[model samples]
Target: MPEPVTLRPRGGMIIAAIALVIAAAALVFIAIDGGLLDLARWAWPVVLLGWGAWLLYLRPYVRVSEGFVEISNLVRTYRVPWGDIDSVDSRFALTIRTRGGRVIRAWAAPAPGARQALSTQRADVTHTPGDDDTRRPSDAEGTASGDAAGLVRRELERHRREGTAAVGQTALTWHPLLIAGTTALAAAAVVSLVLPHG
Candidate 1:
């Protein structure tokens, strides 16, 4: 079997971490400026607890091998076999179509100049179908396809035909949920300040 190929969304972890930091900072600033020391005592804990839970629960979990691809976003895990892939296409997003006619989407960072090279090479291969020496052009193509960038495209295509038997999506990152949570928590802190506390 060829070496296992694994592909993951770029900057996913970095972006998540940055967002968490920003949310935490905003919460801290509100607590200090709003004179809600008591509220901070409670709200900070909640924020910390929520942040910790998110770090533990919302992290990306993805692995790909020669035979299958596995991805987990805490809430759901998807395991797609290699045979079910139909075709892989790269545009603004990397899209994979399965044999069952479903499409899966993920962010892909296609290497600069690589796509043009691959297209040129593919065209060259298509024009010379009669070349019997498999070791020449075929080997080069295989090497390119097996590389990390190539694997991203290949896996997407594979997942389409093999059928994404075990895949799902969820808001595991600090996107809308984290932003909303922080806003609500800040609002609650403000309300707590105005209301008389027994």
Candidate 2:
């Protein structure tokens, strides 16, 4: 069996992380020049931005293996076996429909903008054989959603070709740790706002 393939928005994540690091450093410098209360005030925005970056960019991903496709969302992860997948769509994002009629959207892969759609050549959108009439403008090959769908569809086709496809159930799971961490960070931000400054 081949290794699982992980797909996500690397460029955006890198940029967001770098920007946050710079902001955080600046915050630390400003806090050092001021009193302790000023540090608390500066802390929240950094914490908030860090939380946003962690949840929005660093966390979400789609992992495709020989047996299943795993979608890691904000606070939950869904594992859909190849056999359980009824169809995959790229209308707005990399959306998967299970045989049990469950729809899961991947946050990491979003469709392109108007300008991007307009710039796509025919070669960029020549995806696996499927209905073209329903295909949208942003469903180009280079777009996030389109590329992710391609990876999933290709994997699904491989299973079909090897005669290993079947019907199964999609599994859903939540991350308590993620939930707790997010709540804690949000509370800190709120506390910082309400705290009396000297």
In the order shown, what is each candidate's alpha-carbon RMSD? 9.8, 2.1
What is the per-residue lDDT of model 2 for residues 43-147, given as tens digits with 9 covering 90 to 100? 776777777877888789989887899999999999999999989998778999998889999988877767877777766666644566756655666677877
Candidate 2, run of 10 with poorest lDDT: 128-137
- lDDT (10s digit) by residue, model 1, range 132-194: 343123223323222332454445555555764344432223356655765676666567556
TM-scores for all candidates: the values are 0.43, 0.89
lDDT of 1 at 21: 75
| Count of clashes, each model | 13, 0
RMSD of 1: 9.8
